[model samples]
Target: MPTPASLVSPRLPAQAAIAVPTSRIHALRTGARAAGLIAAGLGMLGLLGGWLHWPPLATLGAGSVPMEPNSALMSLLCGVSLIFALRSPQSARRSTCPLAFAALAVAALTLSQWASGVDFGLDGLLVQGGASPPPLTALAFIALSLGLIAMCKRGRIHTQLSEAAALAAASAALVGLLGLIFSVQSLGGETRSPPSAVALPSMLAVLALAAGMMSARPDGPVVSVLASSQPGAQFGRRLLGWLLCAPLLAALLQAGVQRGWVGGSSALALGVFIALAALAAAIVSSARRLNAAALHCELELGQLRQAAVVFRSSNEAIVITDAQANILTANRAYEDITGYPVDELAGQNPRLMKSGRHDTEFYRMIWRELHERGAWRGEVWNRRKNGEVYAVWQSISAIRDDDGSVTNYVSLLADITSIKEAEARLQHLAHHDPLTDMPNRLLFANTLERSLAHAKRHQHRLALLLVDLDRFKRVNDTLGHPAGDRLLQVMAERLHSKLRSGDTLARLGGDEFSVLVADAGSREEIAALAGKLVANAAQPVWLEGRSVDTSISVGIAIFPDDA
Candidate 1:
């Protein structure tokens, strides 16, 4: 049977599998870039408002605290850093470090000035009358800088660290945003006097920075899990959206009551009811979908178990490998044919059984076919544990994931050593004489035709000599056919030894033999070779306790000279 191109698990229905769309990934990256741009634009507006005396641009509205000049500058630095962090790792690190460090330094210095009760010149450095950013805003900027730094580094731990920092910054910024929305008077009370609260624009900028950081590093564990197309992520996203929007909905109702559009108690009661109803509805919808998905997964798992059984019990040697071609598992038949146990073969590269018969280019073609067409089938010679070379008809298939990335390779190998041996034996018998173990008449004629063509093309000479054992009929009549057979074999070996390595010696039939001398050089060389053949044939050989002598008569025909 032909090996399956994709294994059972990969063949599952699209709905039953986790399909991470390439378009979605691209959207996430684009969103990250947009978020960075938005943060930078907001920062630039704040800087302009501070300089141009525009309250709306800096504070986002009348009676709101303005985003400090230092805060706006930090935001600008972080925005640039976040954008740079989205690039290739090497370039990201090189470009993002300076911006991230500058942001970190400014935020640290501002926080240090606040804690020590000192006026840091950094606050009013950009604007003459500007106050330092609120303590909460400075802390958020610090977290944002650290996150950008972590995002530029490689490894899962660094990714998780960056994600954690982004979440921390987002949470801090969200608190500031909530304070502004609810008009909370006590949110930033850090001194005898009311401390300057986190500005509306500053909070928004930090939120944008946090969002951009998370979106830029989609491979991070937290982002990957949240953005995944699995059932759990989808369900979690639904509940999360509801939770965020439900509070805002409740807050709007509270604002209406404060404005006297509704009774306070009635608004509170209605808000509770609405929140609970939405929660219950979301739960019901998610539960039904998840239950259906669970059933589908169960069916798929059962099918995979059956496939596993077939894989283990199959007569053909099967090997499963990771994308890197490291062996993951192999069937019993594989162990039997390769003479290696599963324990030893596991985690090993498939090149362990390579035979020297094929060159590097041969394996390159197989890999090329597998990548282009996802499958390849051909004969391969591999060495066994005992150093015996064996041939196998091998079929390899690449197994890909829902993302169209190759995840594993499945190789099915069937031993063809015995078949190859049988073919070789049949081929040899068809082209050779049985008695003297030399080329037969048919093979000799074909060889002569090919040699003549080669000689004609290259302007070379060739000699075709027909040789006969003199008085062979007398030996057959007196000493029996067995002695005559032995005499023919002996004469054939002697005649072959007298010619060059590129010569063909064939036994036509009975005492008749032919020799093809390719590239025969000159007439003198041909005559010398014939004399040597005659001298060697005259030598005696013992057969059945008696010495038998044989002589050969040669008739030469040169190509283009005598034809």
Candidate 2:
């Protein structure tokens, strides 16, 4: 677990919060629901007019003829769907089944009327010739049905579905409105015909449906993404709005120009001016968002640069390796300690530094610990580039991906060669004499105990001699302590030279020494060795450019005989 301070990055407070903003989404959804209700009202009005045979209603419905029962029925179904959309969004989301069935029925009746001049059993019951709905009406219903299907199947509107639904509704409205305008305009021309009967109500209904769908959930994935404080989302949302409005605006502008209500040149200039204004708004918004993103990236880059600085300047060696234990890179300290350049180590296995002091089982144990615990730390002996084996204290950690698979390994090591050497020197000094560099009494006693046990087990005799230097204090008092020390070293060397390879010689203190002669055949042999040691010590008299006389008194003990 990380501390709270560690969880937060000091450099990036702006990016710390990830919660979505909902104010814009709520406003958009409310507007869409309101539009859907307005569309439903218009549809109902059209339905009532066509059923009551009122001329005003008929004009809005079937353009001077009463709407056929089939047309009225389809309008009623669309009105119901819009009402469902407004009242119960969740139920409306899953209401595609009924809407699809109704759309298919409307499509079938319209096709029958278009192809065979058949009325689908309503020939005599409603107004005759103008009963069939226009092709755009069928298309509108199909688009709505598809939109509903998309919404229901996905359970929630995603990006692609929202785009498709918005495009379908926008296209339906554009086609119907454009067709109605053209029909009205053509009335003033030589060729005069009534507008398609389905135009007004169907256009209004689909527009309402599109608005409702867009506002169904203010914080839905589509709206949330589009309204986010991100450059790409802002640009895309603006672009989509421009595309939806551009065709209708252009068509209206062209109609005004053709009707002489506006000059063509003036209209073209106005269109261009409006387009540039929209483009400027989009650019400014995108620029502001992108500037924020750039600043965020710069802060992150600074942090990375700081981390790089620390990595390069650290005293300890650091190595990074791939999953297979091949070295990828090493820091400057690694190069200094290992005596290998970064380039030389690259693409080479870490085993190239193995000292061969540890057996294969040792390496196997290291790998096992790493796999189980994701890290291993201990003292390891590795060979330097100059072929010298040196000790290092190393820690290796596994770096893993989000899925918990190992991706890389980071090893941190420090050379402990000097420390190990110091520890060995301290241990030797603890059990040896400082002046003569000989085993002290503590070590000699341990050796004597072991020797005595061995002799008793093998049924052999061992002899011990304790020698005390005579007249050594007089030389130290007259010639100085340095001369006395040199004399002691010389004496120790002489005694050591006289002993057999298997014998032990140790300095007990200032001028007293002890020797252990193991496997001495008899007391006669021990007595002869003691006399020889005594004579050798008595002859050593050279010190400080003068002949200093030094003599020793020897005391001998036979281990089993004394016992």
Candidate 3:
């Protein structure tokens, strides 16, 4: 759980927050969604057109006029949605309405159109030579309808909307054209006139929406003149977006002529569409292949997330700073251990946790090491969220970028309070006798060496005494070692309690012991402590079964003066 400060206050550093601004993201989303709706609408018309012509509907009912009214309505709705979509590129909610309309249009057009046309007893849905409108007239009408659409919304354009609308229109056109060609043979090559009625309306709807949407957007000479003057000019990336649908147009021509669905002028127009559609499909496919070839060139990201998750959940104290020695990021763990909210310390220095245990020079050394090596792994004294101080064993490292420059610093730390207690226990064990729980021979040796050095340097005197517990073996054999050990522990305690702060005592394993009296004025002072030790051991000690009395014999020597 994070502290209140961390939860309520600001988080995330200044640099990272600035890199991804909210405004730019919103603009891109609006633009992209508008573009997508346009694409989907065009696709609906093409597919619906292909079905209407290929399946061949001969006048089954009075309603079977020129073209399917439902498809035209769908194309109209798609155009309308696209116009509205100009405002929100990133939004899916607004785009769905148009998509639904286009879908409904396709469904109604397909079913109703299928029912309207009649199937011939022989050669694919063939119509007699003198049926209704000629095939060429229908094609020309579709083109005229699309041109009218372009005219209505030719007010103005900007690079963004122009690029978006243009791309959508071109793609939709190719799709609708291809679909019409594919369906031509099924509809009755010579008699069917549905394509003619549909072409003008569908194209008009598309062109009108593109013009309306583009005009409302901002414009520069580049976007306006380039698009308004040259419908086929290559400007910036506009050409690429337009080129995406080229293959669909070419496919339309192939279905109509190579397959022999239409004749003469219609065939030539179909051929042109076929050439364009083939190229578009090829380009989309080629782009995908090229991207696959350079997959490894992209840098691997997202690995940092796993480690960051672990750091957030951990219970140890943590501190995060930047390459500039200023703290930026911290985690929940830091809040839990320090009683500070993560946000309170964000963008601040690590002084928030200063325990004041070490001097400035000590910290300077640590900083120097970190800067020189790009990492420093060691222990440091840190203050809690409150004023208390604690010892922490920490590992700190530099976070770097691809260019090998340090960006931030991360620290992982653990508390070591129990470790300090263990050290004191080990020191006692080394100096004191285990049986007596008092200072031992090793401690006496260390004290003697120190005393000798001090006496040589400052003309000081020190005293030493060695003692042996008397009649302890008889008591041990009779009452067991437990009583003997208890007697030694009791005597060691008595002598230890009687000693001055400067004095020292040791148990030489079993019943033997020693004492040190430093800077002794005379022989009598040293002898006096030795005599007191022997008398203290003579006191009675109580055992479960019996009361035992123990005594010790003592010897004494004074440092420098005695030597």
Candidate 4:
């Protein structure tokens, strides 16, 4: 089990957060550019009309008022502000704010002139003689300026506020368009006082500028659904043109009747007929879309049900986590293998099971590979809930959403502890004696080679001893092989006891042994150890109700002196 300290601090570093910009955002950028360009072109034409004394460019017809130069200038500023914001969204405060503020100041001064009946000299700044833009036009410019300013900041709330301001500007622009279409000077119904008419070009410029501002942040509350490719969004898009054109068409029809261009009785009948036809068409389209959506939902539900069954019944341990790596769910096999119940595992980080065998860089590499390649598989050691450290072969995959952002991570782990243990056992048996539980000749030879290198490097002497039991074949022939095996075991233990702690003793074969003294002293010291081993074997023993006599011969070699 992970200690409390390890459990609290996870090993994997926090993943670097990223923003995946989708194609929808790119489309929005194109739309914004188009709207900005259209607005700027119209504003330029209106100014040219005033500067050159050409009324047709500023007005829709002979009776319409010309667009004031100040109104044209404001439109130009708003359009340029939008383009700058889009071009440098990261630095909009520095690049786009000044133009937005200038437009705001102009509109504010225009409003002040109207309210206080005082001339601020802001109207007709470019032309000597022309009516000032209408109060509605000034209001629209103010709303567009605020929207552009709001675009300079970033956040959900700021984006929503910007979209809302764009909507307000669009509403004001639409009102001006309607007023000009009806050829009315009144800002409201006929009962109210007549106000200066908003010029046609000014109204068009404001409308396009408002649209550009709305496009600045398509992910905002009002624009997200409009820009989405969902079924509902498709339906909404289909209905948008009809919703916009129907009311204007009706108003024009009513105006025609009032002007005696069409008879009133016939106009009313035609209006009712058109309204019914539109309603029927909308109903039919909505029914077809709803039916298709219902079928799609059913198909998805069936797929989800099958997936759930597979997830639950899988034999390998499976765990799923959210993008932040907090555990969201785990299968039964996962709980069983980890020794953690489902309830205890939920909301916990997977690092709680870390065995502390791997370093921090190991986990960093895992996360880096996972992020870059989306999948990783490797063997790792983890501690179970009961404090047993075990090996597992694990595979991990990252799941993403439509925008290519990581949503979740799913991992599968298979226990390989028994396999690892078997490998270790096999390795140990390859180099050790089976009967005596000691290093055999193979291990002794390897050890001697390593010791020789070390002694050569340090210029130290090493002593090698070859030991033999004299006349051991006679006992095996008379007392049988079992009696010979008993004597060899006894003699091996006696030789081992006579050696120093740092000395190595090994069984070469039947009744043959080798000893290595890695830290050899003087020649006298080496002879003394050899004499002790000889004396140790000279003692007699009784075996099988008969007295057996045993003796040993010892031969020695010194490194650098012999060989």
Candidate 5:
């Protein structure tokens, strides 16, 4: 049987099932490892060159001096953490706690130096004259502290860690790169000036730490999200355009500074315009993605609402059940037809509707067919909540899962009680006289045949009487057929009252009837019944504001004697 399309369960949208791709995850891990190694190497080289006073590396130092011991120590801590993350992710995650503590200590020391101009004793051992910390050292420690705080969450790498690390690394790298480029430009035609002490190494260390933290865990939010096909991931990838544009913009600014073509106000305006444009692009992209997702959700919701409408408003009673036949849900028509409230019926078995009209075997057959073919359709007798037994045309089908295991069953029922009653009435009308409401001639013949066989088997006397109304046509012709019909109805009632319970009194035609007198003793007894029937017919019938007389002519036939 064909089931309604709306009856099936809804499925998840394809986009909703998307997950991060493996290839992208691999790329993230590789990038993080490479960045971490580069930062570790740069940190170690800068530390060693400064300590040993190596010429080639000393030229790259700030004011021709090596990095401060404390600043190099912080860089070494970040580099070591990144290296550990690259080697063992779980260990790296756990190592974030100590890293965060160390970063906080570094930030505190740097802040003290910035605020009080105090060397804190370490700068005196590392460099002569007890030089003060570079301006960028304070900012680098602040960025490191924030990145470590994000990374140290409950001793695990999380989405917050990745985002914070990325922002910290990007900001630190941009500041250092910009400052170094400006310093190099100033050296073009004049004496060379020293670069910031912490800028070069801090930038490399921050980038390594950020990349390492992002790829430290496969299940980390940033790596998983970036690897996925979600619109947000696509938008995030698009934001990488800023990373590419930053260097070009920095180069242009550096050139302008060198040529004295751009003032501070012009440069500030250029920066503001670029920032606003990027922000607008990001907002527009995010809005478009959100709109598409919202539209898809609305369409799915609309379909669900339409299906609910059809289920609630259907004329046929609908019931949904689990595989075990426990009622899960029912519609309004189910309540109307069964006279049971939905709340009362839920969780109950459908056997509550049993009317005792069908046996256990009948239900067994129904289930057998349902299991074999997944559907069964036929008429069933069920009881209403008011104790009224009624018939229904019911159809049942199984709802299966992808594995072909039955998950639920749906039943549709239409009340067929009126139709059944009408069918019985039609059968009766075909075999009985309409006017007198008695078995007609065709039915009388069949009764006579059965009576004859019974009498012959028992050696008893049987008699058949055909009673016809005399002057019946004259009465119809004068008083009308309605009066005639009324007279015939009265005669039938009178004759039926006089006959024995076992005897047959059938109206065979307009003015004729057949009576079967079984177990008669002799002809005299049969004649007496015939005379009585004639007397009953001769009585007056009151109809149509007048009394009309009707007479019947009786003819008798004996079973053996007539034969």
Candidate 6:
């Protein structure tokens, strides 16, 4: 059986498949070590940079500039975090060393940034401005963004940490936004410190955006992992993760600016973070909705399959045709009735079932009526697969498309052979007498009427002879009705045999009958035919091993003049 197409996503490239597992382990390990280094750097940066102190081994003995040591710590923080991230991709969280390390490193960096006192604007961006520090901070965040995107996309690690990635994105945005706001605003009279404090939070936001994009792959393993998260309900849990980080980062940025970080505005960075977090939350919510929808669609698919099976197995003969009157499908009953396999019949002309009993005009009339009335329910003769013909009661209708175009045709048919036989029997009952099996008074009257009308128009004589048996009732009384009926049947046969084939003889009832001979020569010929009816009908009929005699009294009537 063919596998359902929807069940699987297309395979990733070979490089993508192999590189993910290999690189991610190292990346995670590096992330751990890097986080530790960055965290320590953050603590030092917190104590020394915020105070603008040039440690004793400081280059050129720091004053307001706070050279070398401050720059060294900031650079180290960025570098260590990058290493942790770079090595962490080992397909995704292969070893907790990398994941836990990176998380702790970032957390340590966050706390250091928090501890640094938000009033730091000492790098000349605030009271005394610098030439390249602000531009450098922006450039660094941009580069980090690009690096994470390249790694996540190429490694295809989004599948490994779906929930975490989404939560991470939201958290990053909040931190970035809050940090930017707090860093840009100056509040209580406080000693502002250094440029790197404000810049750190912005770097984290760029990382968060990369992680968000990575986790969006439809079949990525990240989703399976996300499904395993706790401490949050299905919808709100993800949003909650993000909200927790924003306020802390915001307060830190505010404190950092008071202590003198870069004088540049932090507001823009904070706004970017908020936007990113909202977007990430939206993405996760949409994914859950889609999964629910897919489940519903799967249930509907099963019902449709069951319905198809039912349609195929129905016992009533059903034929479905294209608009052009070609077979499209047929059911088991159709095959049973026509002795044709549905597979063999599909794409063949449906007209193959038409027997030649009807002429062209007859079929045209049927089509005309059907098209006009939207349906035709009547009897027809159709051929079986073996060239045998059968009578069927068929109903055909047009199947229309939404645009009112006739797209198909459907027919339901059943065998009516027995019904036809019953109809023939009814007709025999109407025209002939039951006891004698001869044309009855009703048939003789019809024949007389037609013959008289034709004779008048053609200037010819027509005659009718009334027949009565002399003693049919007495025979019935003596020999029983069975013998009497036999005598009547014999008399009817004799009268029929004695007449010319064109003449008609009928027993009206009991002893009564009528003979009709049309286009007669004259009264003499009419008299002769009537006399023969009397003589021949006198023959005895055999019944139960005995002979019963029957005689007739005939009254003759000639058309035009009763002579």
Candidate 2 off by > 4 Å: 1-303, 453-461
Clashing pairs counted in every model: 0, 1, 41, 1, 0, 58
Q: Report lDDT (Cα) of residue 186, candidate 4.
A: 43
Q: What pairs collide in candidate 2?
A: 29-215
Give all TM-scores, in the order shown: 0.90, 0.47, 0.45, 0.77, 0.45, 0.45
lDDT of 6 by residue, 343-394 (tens): 7886799778889988898778877876787677788898998998888888
lDDT of every predicted structure (CA atoms): 0.83, 0.71, 0.55, 0.80, 0.71, 0.56
Model 4 misses residue 239 by how many Å?
A: 2.9
- Model 2 per-residue lDDT tens digits across residues 15-110: 232223455655665676566566556656655665565646645634533444455555456545644654454776656447646755665656
TM-score-better candidate, 1 vs 2? 1
- Model 6 earns a TM-score of 0.45
| Model 4, span 1-563: residue lDDT tens | 22212222324432212221577778778889888887777778778888888888776454467777888888888888889899876658986789999999988888878877788776656788655666788888998888889899988778888888888988887777666555556452222222436777887788788777777787666567766655666566657666656547767777798789998788878878877787678768877888898899799768766766777788998888878889877878888899998679878999999999999999999999999999999999999999999999999999887788787788999999999999877777777776665688999999999999999999899999999989899999999888888788878888989988899998888888899998899899999999999998888767778889999988999997785
| Candidate 6, superposed: residue stretches over 4 Å from native | 1-303, 369-374, 385-389
For lDDT, candidate 2 versus 4, the one ahead is 4
Residue 529 error for model 1, in Å?
A: 3.3
lDDT digits (tens) for residues 1-563 of candidate 5: 11233235423244333445566667777776676676556656656666776634533543343445556666666666655555554765677557656756775776676667555765555544333446455555566556655554433345566466566656666666666655643111223245434345555566566666666554555555666767777777667667646766866876786788997678768877986898789879878997898898799878777778788888889998878898777888889999998889877999999999999999999999999999999999999999999999999999986457787899999999999999989999988898888898888889889999999999888888888888888889988888877788888899898899999899877788888988876888888888888787777777778777778888888888998
Count of clashing pairs, candidate 6 = 58
RMSD of 6: 20.8
Candidate 5 matches the true fold with a TM-score of 0.45
